[model samples]
Each structure stands twice: as structure tokens, then as C-alpha cells.
Target: MGEDCNLHEQACAAVLAPGVAVTLDISPKPVRAMTDLEFTVSLSDRNGPVDGAQVALDLSMPGMFMGENRSILSGLGNGLYQGKGVIPKCPSGKTLWRGDLQVQVGDVTGNVWFLFSVK
Candidate 1:
């Protein structure tokens, strides 16, 4: 008797199916140098504000090592969010700076990278 009997493989294939993919969105692209930096995020294909989602912000300066950075936000009602943070400036060292923003909700994640100069 020469017959293939791999029923387990067939069962596994039947149960497994493709799932939805996660994507990131950030508003106010092409930021500029100013008093404060602000932006918004919309959950792609996800209903709701994605409560308790974690956001990471990093700042760097031209020709200099990265420095002080923080994250703060204000709830704008109905799943909308706004955040304000500080970026440190150094003279004779780093003037122009760039920022990196990372947002994570469950298994989904997003990122924003922007550049700005100090006045």
C-alpha cells in the first residue's frame, strides 16, 4: 500500500486564512520650525480612538547627537488627539533638528519623521 495520508496538513490549511493588515496615518505633513509641534493620527480600519496606545518621540540635531525629547497629548473628543512637546536647542553645536514619532496600538504601529530648524 503506497498512499499519502497527511490529513493534518489539510486540516491546518483549511483553518488558516489571510487576515487584515495594519497601517499608520499621521496628519499635518511637512512640519516647520515654530513654538510647538502638533499632529494627529487616525486608526486605519480600526473603530475607535485606540485608547492607551503608546507614542514614542525622538529628536535630533544636525551635526550633533540626539537630545532631550518628550511626548504630551490632549484629548479632543471623539477619538481625535492632539499633542504638544518640547525640543531642546543648543548653540554652537546643534541648530537644525529633526523629530521621529512612533505610535503603537496593540499589533498595529505607525511612524512620523519630520525636520525643523531652530531660530
Candidate 2:
């Protein structure tokens, strides 16, 4: 598991290609479970912000099953996509969750994971 991202303090980013990168930003800060969250996903390249792509994110816990929590985002132009979703609180008191961001441009698809903790 890629447990390097801290989505509470800042946006976590991962590279797809040499100059292409994807970032996952969530708010309001100090993410908590069973609350509405605004998800902002961005894709950029050497030229600039890449737009007109289908973007979505699947929220899950590493090494555990937490049902299906997916957020399908709409393009807000300039490579930024926004969506709303909720993170369900775990019964086992698990704080760690993974935001599996999926980016699709044309027929090509890419994925990146952002690890975060819920209060």
C-alpha cells in the first residue's frame, strides 16, 4: 500500500508519465468519516492543465473490505474535476483509507492511490 500521502494537510500527488502528474485534494480539512467531502482531482502535463477527461475515485481501506465507495467527478475545466462523496466510519476503528483515483483520457486509463486518515 502507498501510505505516503497525507490528505489532511495537503494534496497528495503521483506521477503518471515523465511530465504528467495527478493530484488528489479533499476538503474540509481533517477528514472525518460519515461526512460529506468535496473531492478535487487534477491532471496536468508539461503544457498545462489537461481537461475533458473522465475522472473518478474509489475509497477503500488497505487490507480490509469496506464496501463500494466511489465518487464520479465532473470536469470543472482546466484539468480540475470535482465530486462529492462520503467516507463511512469503520466499525473496527480503522483510521486509514485509500483514495484510489482513476483517470481516463481517451482509451488510456491511469490510476493512483492517496492514503489518508479519518477522524
Candidate 3:
């Protein structure tokens, strides 16, 4: 597979199996800081554009009395996904607000955690 290949189906179908290639690029690897929170994720097959595949964004926030949970984000056109509402602001006190972010592409999902100052 190539950068433009669809890893979702390819991963499951075994067509590009046995560690074929890693497609999908989540820009801003570390996700240091984002204001607009507008990020670009590239998902394309060798043919170009996966088109109409289900993508989901799941968010988990720590330090919440309720505990971690899943938040659904909306999808933009062309392999771009946009999260709704304002992201959790900086936390307050000695502890900071921490949470995990998960991105799903078909049957495959990836995740990362983010921490911010306490508000």
C-alpha cells in the first residue's frame, strides 16, 4: 500500500496484509497545541479518495468525576473530520484536565491523550 491507499479495508481484507503499508496521515503528529482545532487527516487508497467510508472521532476526558466517556465528532468532506463544540479548556488547581482522543477509520481506530492547564 501507499500513502494514498485505504488502510481500513486493506487491513481487514488481508489484501495489503502482513504489514503492507501505512496509509492515513494525521497532521500535527504530537498535537502540541491547537486553537481552531482544525486538523487535516489524509486517507486515500491507491486509486485516490476512499470516499463514503465511515469515520468516527471518540474523545475521552480524565479528571471528570464521572470518568472517561466517548464523544462523537462530525465528518467534513475529503477525508477531513471536524469535531463539534469547543474543546475542553484548560483545567484548574494542581491537577490538569487530561483525556484521550480516538479516531476511527472503518474497523480501525487510533487514539492519543491530551493534557491542558486547569481552568
Question: Which of the numbered candidates is closest to the native, going by highest TM-score?
Answer: 2
For each candidate, what is the lDDT? 0.44, 0.88, 0.36
Better of 1 and 3 by TM-score: 1
Leading candidate by lDDT: 2
TM-score of each: 0.49, 0.92, 0.40
lDDT of 2 by residue, 23-102 (tens): 88899999999989999988998899999888999999989999999999999999999999999999999888888888
Q: What is the lDDT of residue 91 in candidate 3?
A: 41
| Candidate 3 residue lDDT tens string, 3-91 | 23332223111122222212222222222222333333334445554444443433334535523334444555664444432334434
Candidate 2 stretches greater than 4 Å from native: none
Reference-based TM-score, model 3: 0.40
Full ranking by TM-score? 2, 1, 3
In each prediction, how many residue pairs overlap at the backbone (N, C-alpha, C within less than 3 A)? 0, 0, 9
Model 1 agreement with the true structure over 1-119: per-residue lDDT tens digits: 00121211211011001231222222333333334655453333335334555655566774676556656444454444456655554656445665555666567565555555444
